[model samples]
Target: MKHLTGPAYVDIRERALRFVRDELIPLEREARLGPEDPWPRDLLRRIWKRSNELGLLKAALPVELGGPGLSTVELCLLKAEIAETGALFALHVLGELSGPPRVGSLMNFASAYQIERFFKPVMEGDKGICFAMTEPHSGSDAASIKTSAVRDGDDLVINGRKHFISGSPFADIAIVICVTDPEAGPKGMTAVLVELDAPGVRMDETYVPMSGQHIDADIVFENVRVPAANVIGGFGNGLRLGMARVNLNRLLHTSWMIGAARKVYRMSLDYARTRMQSGGPIARFQAIQHMLADMATTLFACESMMLHAAMKADQGEDLRMEASACKVFISERCFEIADKAVQIHGNVGVTKNHPVELTFRQLRLARILTGTSEIQRNAVAREILQA
Candidate 1:
């Protein structure tokens, strides 16, 4: 975490905290009106505008791209702090769950035209974007995506269905990965920028996952013709373009889990200290004390592992193993911490009114979303064996 400390980092971090406390937290109730309700677009736009003015909207991007160009460690630390606020609107404050920054390092590979037409508006808080790669049959196995894009003179006809695409319902465009040359296998795949309003493009259905957020949708492309110029990072390089941001994305997700765990730990601590049980407050019981100690200790370890991986990324080191290991360890441990928080709060923790309940559900999904724990473990095992 030392890598995250510096005068510049401190200034940006404090600003982000102030923005979250002053701007986002107060509106959490309105932003999260219901478990399955869509976020009010007007509210999100206001937050985005304010965050952009504060230089926090694109904080993870490079300076050349209209951002402050914070290092990976600093960006991850900032994300953790925002997530620590435990407000649903925190995701919108930094545009983490969606928009240009969510593309992560992949934006580095964008063509000038693509950046100007697609990326700039999103960065400026005027438009939105979603990464579309998961298909009906493909989840963690990206190579198996069945989405096909065939060349037709200067146009490409795209036909596929992407499910569980985050922000698709509201995004103006989607960075779609499609099979350009079936015979070439993984090398045949390419990433294309497809406007959601294109002909034959359909927002099929919205999904409210276990987290109860209506941020994901199923998108169908039926002969959606896009100019060949929309291709990103050249043809047959979609996998590479997508993998470019995988390491940093994993670390960021881990930061969210760490922050959520911290929030729940505090909630549980306050509950234990005040909730009367047996002959005294729950904090006096060894059972509750043990849970608090475990939560605190594991949180420290999770933060250390996440920051170390983030530092490796900042140093330009390959983080295939480190990121997966960090994701696996932190996600699992923090989820466990959330479970302990629930236990310490007893029946009250599981109720919908309690923040711990939402935190529990959200942290549970972390293990499955950005590569499942089994997938991460397999990645680590493969690396170890090959080495």
Candidate 2:
């Protein structure tokens, strides 16, 4: 984390911590209810408004794009601070999950039309956008996407089904990746912006995953007509465009993992120091001390790896391998830390609504999202073997 520390980073992190503590934690009950029920629109708007007022809403956007233009490391610092609070609304505090920040480096390729119609609204919190790349059959193998978008004179008619789309239920539009020229393989894939309300567009019932977040849904496109102008980053460049921000995204995910791991580690430490057995604290035992020591060391390593990758990204270096390695290592180790925290808490840890319990589920999901641990390993191995 030293590489990420500076006056600006410190200021941003402190503000983020304040925001999480003051604004999000009190709303924990509402956030807990979010998995089973829809978050009130007004409540979401209030959170976004407060975030915007704090100058944190679009902090990840480039300076040229009307944001403070924080570096990748700085942004991760902010993310880690918010996540360390164990607030369920950590993603909402900075609009990381479903707004402009989520668009990430892809904004570099957005056309003027996209900037005006799709991107700006999201930045303003007036609308939301979902990146629809994962299809039912192409979860990890993005190149095998079966969705098709055939050019029909002036429009592309999209026809396919996409499931497990994060933020799809609340998004006003989707950046749908489709196979436009099947014969061209990966080159044929193109990203098309389609309004969610467009004719032939249908959203299935929203579903909550093991992490207990109702942020994903299934979308069905039946000849959904999107104007040719909606194609962003040029035709046949969808894969590259979508991947442009992936390295940074992976690093940010690790930052959140580090934060959660730190939070649970502290919780376990406090519990071990106070939990009494045989007229003594559990911290007196070597086994408990060993677990705490392992958690602390692993957390240090996770932060080091994440910050190293973030610095490489900030330096404009290609981080394909480093990003994958960090994602796999940090996510796995952080999940282990959460497991240890649960063990330390014993009965209270696995109980519903417990912070450590929720962290456990969320960290478990982290390995599968942003490229599964297995897929990330394959990527690292491929890069190594090819080199």
TM-score of 2: 0.94
Q: Rate the local accuracy (lDDT) of all candidates.
A: 0.85, 0.84
Per-residue alpha-carbon lDDT of candidate 2 for residues 246-350, written as tens digits (9 for 90 to 100): 877887889889988999999999999999999999999999999999999998888878877888888999898999999999999999999999999999999
Highest TM-score scorer: 1
Off by over 4 Å in 1: 1-3, 30-32
Per-candidate TM-scores read: 0.95, 0.94
Enumerate residue pairs that collide in model 1: none
Q: Across residues 1-387, which tens digit of lDDT does each residue of candidate 1 receive?
A: 554577777888888899888877777664556545677767777777788888788877788766777888887788888889877677776777666586656667888898889988889887778999988789999999899999999999999999899877778889999999999989999999999998999997645788888788999999999999999889999987877778668877887888889999999999999999787898998988999999999988988888788778888988989989999999999999999998998899889847898889988998888789999999899989999
Candidate 2 residue pairs in backbone clash: none
Determine which window of 10 residues in candidate 2 has minimal summed lDDT. Answer: 30-39
Query: Candidate 1's error at 67, in angstroms?
Result: 2.0
Of candidate 1, the 10-residue stretch with the lowest lDDT total is 28-37
